[model samples]
Target: MRMFWGAAALVMVAGCQAAKPADPAVEKAWVRLPAVQGNPGAAFLTIRAGNKPLTLLSVSAPFATRTELHESMAADHGSSSGAGGHMMTMAPVKQIDVPAGETVKLAPGGKHVMLYDVAPGVQPGAKVPLTLVFADGSRMETQAITLAAGDAAPE
Candidate 1:
């Protein structure tokens, strides 16, 4: 009976232990070159959550004075207006949630990191260092390739 009780205790202890979460992954990170100083630039990437859900708290880049998460959406213009076409606007977001086992894409005309007061050194073909801060107080450092201002989204 003593041996059986010891075995049961070991099994219970193992069952109570939770599995460790996997680290998040960042891929295809790229930054758009700004037209001029003081103009905001944009960064796009694909983020994949690990075994658990992840929240992207903020983003920082050495090339920009300030960075914030932003979402671009079509503006609601009254139907009667003519010749203006459709307008798009971007708004800042506090945090972005990446679901577990799913990939969240930050692409043009969607969700992206807005870089304000861009430094002069940020240009096409330049490699920019970026840091991604998570809600869990963890940070991921990565680099993004800079593309021309008029360049389209990378394939």
Candidate 2:
């Protein structure tokens, strides 16, 4: 009986180790205020998926009533405004996939989160609370620094 119990305990420990997932991290989170008052805002950040694939479901913030995952893609090459007749367009994305052991950046003029009806207090130098929801039903709560219209992102 003692030998059977030991064997079962060893198997349980091994199974626990095998079931562990990689650690995920969010860094350099910052919010960019709108250029004009009462307009919408945006947020940028870097997501690191360590040794496991991840899907970013949505972003929510206390300052904005509506937040969404969005992407900027090139469209309508017929227009000739230079740059090889390429025009930028914003599209709503349901989710953003981050591969295993990779880093995805949400930067200016690229993939980012759109914030609507932002509050007045979410100004430069302010720390706004942000919640990142993942497809695995995991939520990460972090604070994002606010940047002015012309301010640069964090290093």
Highest lDDT: which candidate?
A: 2
Overall local distance difference test of candidate 1: 0.88
Clashing pairs in 2: none
Summed over model 2, clashes come to 0
Cand. 1 TM to true fold: 0.81
Model 2 alpha-carbon miss at residue 87, Å: 3.1
lDDT by residue for model 2 (42-96), tens: 9999898977788999998988989999999878766767667777889999999
Window of ten residues with lowest summed lDDT in model 2: 76-85
| lDDT, candidate 1, 19-61, per-residue tens | 5555689989999977766788899998989888889999989
User: How big is the RMSD of model 2?
Assistant: 6.4
